[model samples]
Target: MNEKEFKKAIDHYRSLIDKEMANEKVIDGKFVGPKKLTKKDKIDLEDIIHPDRPFLSKDAPEDLDSLYVTTFRVGNLKKPEVLTKAGYGTDVIGGIEFGSNLVKTGLIESVDDIAPFLAKYKIGILDLFREEEVEDGKKLDIRVYECIDCAGMPNIGEPVCYFETGMLIGILSELTGKEVFAEELRCWTSGYSCCQFDVDIKETKKGLDG
Candidate 1:
């Protein structure tokens, strides 16, 4: 994402506080009492707290490219395997939470609307190019263009969008209520223009108690 888009995202996040707390007002020094929260409000509140870093701060870099470079240095240059695994694992939870919240808040009707949601939130451009039935469930071939993590990166001979892959898996798993797995098949770091993911979701067997 560019500086303008990043700042816009931050602004959108800041705007939520007012929207969610429309009924609340400052009492003397602090906003008093826990106001009755709707499901949407709760979702918004959850989002504000769940992120790794607070978006409320005004102090930030003009561009996020440096941050991206630093992350690459730490994850790829330092301990590649360990950092990649850790990032994927952690971001999975974040994705699940975000997907659940989006649905609950009526932000998007369902998983079919995820591509627009990603673009609206300045995450990436997601395209599900292929899908077919498998014995267990289904497989999806997805592509991500202008990925926030590694869209224009140099060739590192390995995929570096572990977080993005894990997030997609988590989102699909939560939305479909199935076991999801994903493998990064292509990446800009691997001399690709866009990122590609091979995702598989399997259906679970149920007890025939009924």
Candidate 2:
């Protein structure tokens, strides 16, 4: 997309996010938080695909600038719920494809390699506490220290690394050859020293019988 088009897209997204945040409230004196977007309010699938490409283009002068964690934290200050969903939406639309390519290209060859690869790329320092076979598939307890998304961020009362959670989902799904889902169980923004994810691997039909 061209500069004007990219700016329009970003503005449109912000409008939607603002609308969603508008419904936020306090219940029993506790913050209700940003409301979820309904079907009509969601960002279109096509728009979510590679939404970062515009920002990543070398030809884009804005690309010369780097966004700090504080910038994101400030954005999340009032719209954590919507922002989290936006991150997940990006993953479902294209982040998975992007992450799977890491394995497809031999960058990540095994489950044991995930941590080192993450560290190599400065994504985070990954720690695998344990993995166990569940009834249908597997469960992994994973932690990330110095998480790019929320490390050193002040307590935000909720987990705020939906993007990273989705990244792990994609990476693990490709690495294990199964459908994987990950949930952010803890985060620095939620008063944790590290980010923790509970990953669930689902057995496919082929794997079920194999």
Candidate 3:
């Protein structure tokens, strides 16, 4: 990730922690709701968050859409892991392009709203956060339990949910009309109970301006 993306992510994390603090919890050594503030700076929140944080080291990937695969085989893709973002861009943005065409043809609503609609065709639940769950100007977090790609695949020992991450960014950017970034923070294959992704959404005002 670049500097701008890094800053946006860090700022969102701080706000997430802030929300937790509001509920009266000692998180990262700070209290906000009813407890006293122990230190001026706890863990120096800014110092801990940065960009270019690589989590995947998979040697290869396979694109599932390339074939008329079965229901059990979705979200699969093949690509060199070195490119980092290539597989995701190809899959996610390509899906958006296809969805856009459908919308233009009056076959669907919009690219942004297509996720939940398409979830029926997918293997796992693509749970997106409701508007009330997120405050304005903050990043969006999504979860996918029993993800099609990672759940049944042989354990790869790391997060390989990049395609879903990219899909989320594409969906939101199509809806919000702003450049957004998505990162997979956890994956079922990575030993997490579910697949979790973080997205740096476009600020509502900027999206409105667009």
Candidate 4:
């Protein structure tokens, strides 16, 4: 990934908060309690939280370059290896786009689905840090694969990736300084899938330097 491009995207998203506030748009704060909601509010929240949307970009990968990096957090190395072995040649349910080789894996339908999954599985955040000897840091690359179930299927207008739901939680944990637990993992028809979970950092490990 291009570091500059990634940073630009982060900055652009950060700017949206101020822009929305200036325009008097109602900004939904992070969901922190069980507040009663109206039917319209529930629907609006679902649309924003679980948008079955796919991003169409001419710059997206082509047929010959369909590989993408899939990231995940397996607290233990053994689990990662086990998952890799289990996922081999497995077909994942998702949508495929016409004339393009991009496959979208449906991982979750909405944030509301996270709690149930978390109730079933144990999730943890993983941090991999290292001391750099040089002023410029080195880049680490990981290979992403399409789920075996959908790898050879014809394009049906959905997005696919090899990423796992837990990895996404790890990313959020690192970003928000909280412990994220999974509730559900669902593959979406929307070119991509997302995981929903509640975060709690009450008694997590801290101050480890790699």
Q: What Cα-based lDDT does every candidate model obtain?
A: 0.57, 0.58, 0.46, 0.26
Clashing pairs in 1: none
Candidate 2, clashing residue pairs? none
User: Mind giving the per-residue lDDT tens digits that candidate 3 earns over 1-210?
Assistant: 233543444454445434533454333442223222333211122311221111111111443322222222322423444554445556666655654454555544564445445444443444554333345455666655445555433223345655566656655665656667677755533434456677776565443554
Ranking by TM-score: 2, 1, 3, 4
As a whole number from 0 to 100, the lDDT of residue 19 in candidate 3 is 52
Name the regions of candidate 2 deviating beyond 4 angstroms. Answer: 1-88, 91-94, 205-210
TM-score of candidate 3 on Cα atoms, chains taken together: 0.48
Q: Worst 10-residue stretch by lDDT in candidate 1?
A: 41-50
Candidate 2 whole-model C-alpha lDDT, 0 to 1 = 0.58
**Tens digit per residue, CA lDDT, model 4, 11-113:** 5433542343243312242221112222221111122222211111113454211222111111112334446435522312111121011111323334333
Write model 2 residue lDDT over 1-210, tens digit each, in one string: 344543443454345434533555544443333433233332232322221322223343653312432344354344455675555566453656767887889998888777668655546657676689999888988877656566654445566677678778777788777888888766555544567778888887324555
Each model's total of backbone clashes: 0, 0, 8, 27
Point to the candidate with the largest lDDT: 2
Candidate 1: deviation at residue 32, Å? 57
Query: Model 1 — TM-score against the truth?
Result: 0.55
lDDT of 2 at 27: 40
In candidate 1, what are the lDDT values of residues 1-210, reduced to their tens digit?
A: 445654564455335423533544444443321233222211111222222222211244654544543454344334344464555555656665666566667776677778777765545667676799988889998877656566545544455576677778767776777778887766555545556789998777232222
Kindly report the root-mean-square deviation of model 2 from the true structure over all alpha carbons. 13.6
Q: How do all models score by TM-score?
A: 0.55, 0.58, 0.48, 0.25
